[model samples]
Target: MAYQTFRQEYLQVPPVTRAYTTACVLTTAAVQLELITPFQLYFNPELIFKHFQVWRLITNYLFFGPVGFNFLFNMIFLYRYCRMLEEGSFRGRTADFVFMFLFGGLLMTLFGLFVNLVFLGQAFTIMLVYVWSRRNPYVRMNFFGLLIFQAPFLPWVLMGFSLLLGNSIIVDLLGIAVGHIYFFLEDVFPNQPGGGKLLRTPSVLKAIFDTPEDDPNYNLLPEERPGGFAWGEGVSWNC
Candidate 1:
């Protein structure tokens, strides 16, 4: 009965977010078990191009180091915000959420090349938080039960906390930058007088991932309005 209950809860997670969190956990587990070395997964341009270790490009974004404080912290934020965005803002729009992942990853990878950084998982998490915060601007949020702020300032708050941890602010800044770019293109610019949607999801992906609106079982909930940006209405997430 206990196992069945656990299975039921596990099955309740949305698909994209579930797969992502599972990958992060399994990747870290592989490291903790000594099945793989962190060195092998980190981004190295020479190894990627010359040695043809193409897997590093994607692996680098998967592992957040062995199980510890940083790993646990990042995983929690990643899973929470990613799931929220997927089930809330990106609900029924699976293709667009996947596109956001691809877009953020590509931008982070390109920046990683120049910044000499490895393991962009945290930055990716920051990007997700940023995008979600922007879309739900009127929402209120509490940080660590101390600082209270609106949704948009969440990214900067994380960055400030990172600074206090003696960690480099580069990663957080990169994430905020990338997230702003996505928000600008997808939400902001598209609404401008002359602008149009720049980040169009391909029809192939839409056909495969998107849920059909005409389906009889599709229950359009009020919380899922405007891609789940029902700000100042839903319960706030304390980050």
Candidate 2:
């Protein structure tokens, strides 16, 4: 049964596949162009006591890389998870994928600051993404190409990592909070029957501590939207 869902969700062309492809290309470019330099990563080349650059907050994902086995492993994960989330099988609410990529990157940067290290910071940020994807209800992914299986504990596994690392706990938690608020605002304001002045909602402004929950992402996007199925007419993911 799970295998069937996996095949359906990940096999063929997931809705966000194109986005995933773009992510991979950018990552490769960053690495090849030497743009993924450590000196340029944190906006603090010397690693001395200095303030954040603000730009690195979002530019660092383009710098993701690891030596030897870790590099290939995470690169595969980047491809795998991004593929599912981009596929649009979840049939999510308005432009969820776009927001996930954009804001998620920012959240990662904020996490990096407390981590006091660019690598660790990005790691936690990626973990937050997977956790957010897991929290999305009634959604799952199956990987047949390399990772073939089902998982109900994506969020727990991620949180568990966060728990084990005491050095990174404080900032990591903050990143989680940031991601949660983003999800809530996206789902809530517009979800309110008949759209009003969503730009001025209390939740968007305050970002107050709430239930500590965010939208769990999945291999698919909102089915209600037009792009949910078969590449939205002439568009083809295989390309």
Candidate 3:
């Protein structure tokens, strides 16, 4: 029901999102006035997470680019993809964005930080996962008029491109972590859907995997066939 939820959430777009857009504009203006740097809270997790920090929950999304054209283009993309997601779920999905972005991003960030502090530099982990998302597993990306791998390729593509060429997205691990965690707990957390913990993880993973029509990752949608929802057909949050 990912797609159905998407439709519901889309109808309920959050007010905070618009406020965020305004805040982004205001921040840019402030920076232009030499009041503060654009990257002010890019790395200060504690400061970013403090109370009244609602903006922090959504700021990273505000950082389009400094240039007019690029920023506009990115905004269009954000509107297209993100808005589709928001609209797909209904009107309230924007709130879910805040939840997912914060929850998921934070989880990934914590994992990366933990890995670095407790283990080793594993930036490639994030990079690789992203690179792989550009395919719809069933369809291809429409690149310059040519349909490439698959539409589901977006998540990995965006992830990989960001890690490799976008920026040294060490901070992004935070975003990624929160995302998967939310995916894990979203509909069936605290209370197991499969009745008990015996199949909790797999069942939850399967739920996230199975999607309705308008899911963000097209590839994650259920296959085209006469049948009921199949858990194994969708993307399972592995690692």
Top candidate on lDDT is 1
Candidate 1 on 1-239: residue-level lDDT in tens? 99999999888989889999999999999998999999989989899999999999889889987788999999999989999988887878899999999899999988888996888888888999899888787677888799888888999999999999999999999899999999899988878999999899989889889766786655465663354555665467688
| Structural similarity to truth (TM-score) of each candidate | 0.93, 0.49, 0.48
**With candidate 2 superimposed using the best TM-score fit, by how many Å does residue 38's alpha carbon deviate from the native?**
2.0
Please write out the lDDT profile of model 2 over residues 70-177, one tens digit for every residue. Answer: 455456555655555453433332244544555665555555555555553335344445443534433343333433222424434445554655444554455556
For residue 115, model 3's alpha carbon misses the true position, in angstroms, by 8.6
Question: By summed lDDT, which 10 consecutive residues of candidate 3 come out lowest?
Answer: 118-127
Residue-by-residue lDDT tens digits, candidate 3, 4-109: 9987865555454444445556655666677866565343445555645444434443455464754554444443444333333323233334443344444554
Worst 10 residues of 2 by lDDT: 230-239
**Which is the winner by lDDT between candidate 1 and candidate 2?**
1
Best by TM-score: 1
lDDT of 1 at 177: 90
Question: Going through the candidates in order, what is the number of backbone clashes in each?
Answer: 0, 21, 52
Q: RMSD, model 3, all Cα superposed?
A: 10.9
Compute the lDDT for candidate 3: 0.42
Ranked by lDDT, top first: 1, 2, 3
As for candidate 1, its clashing pairs are none
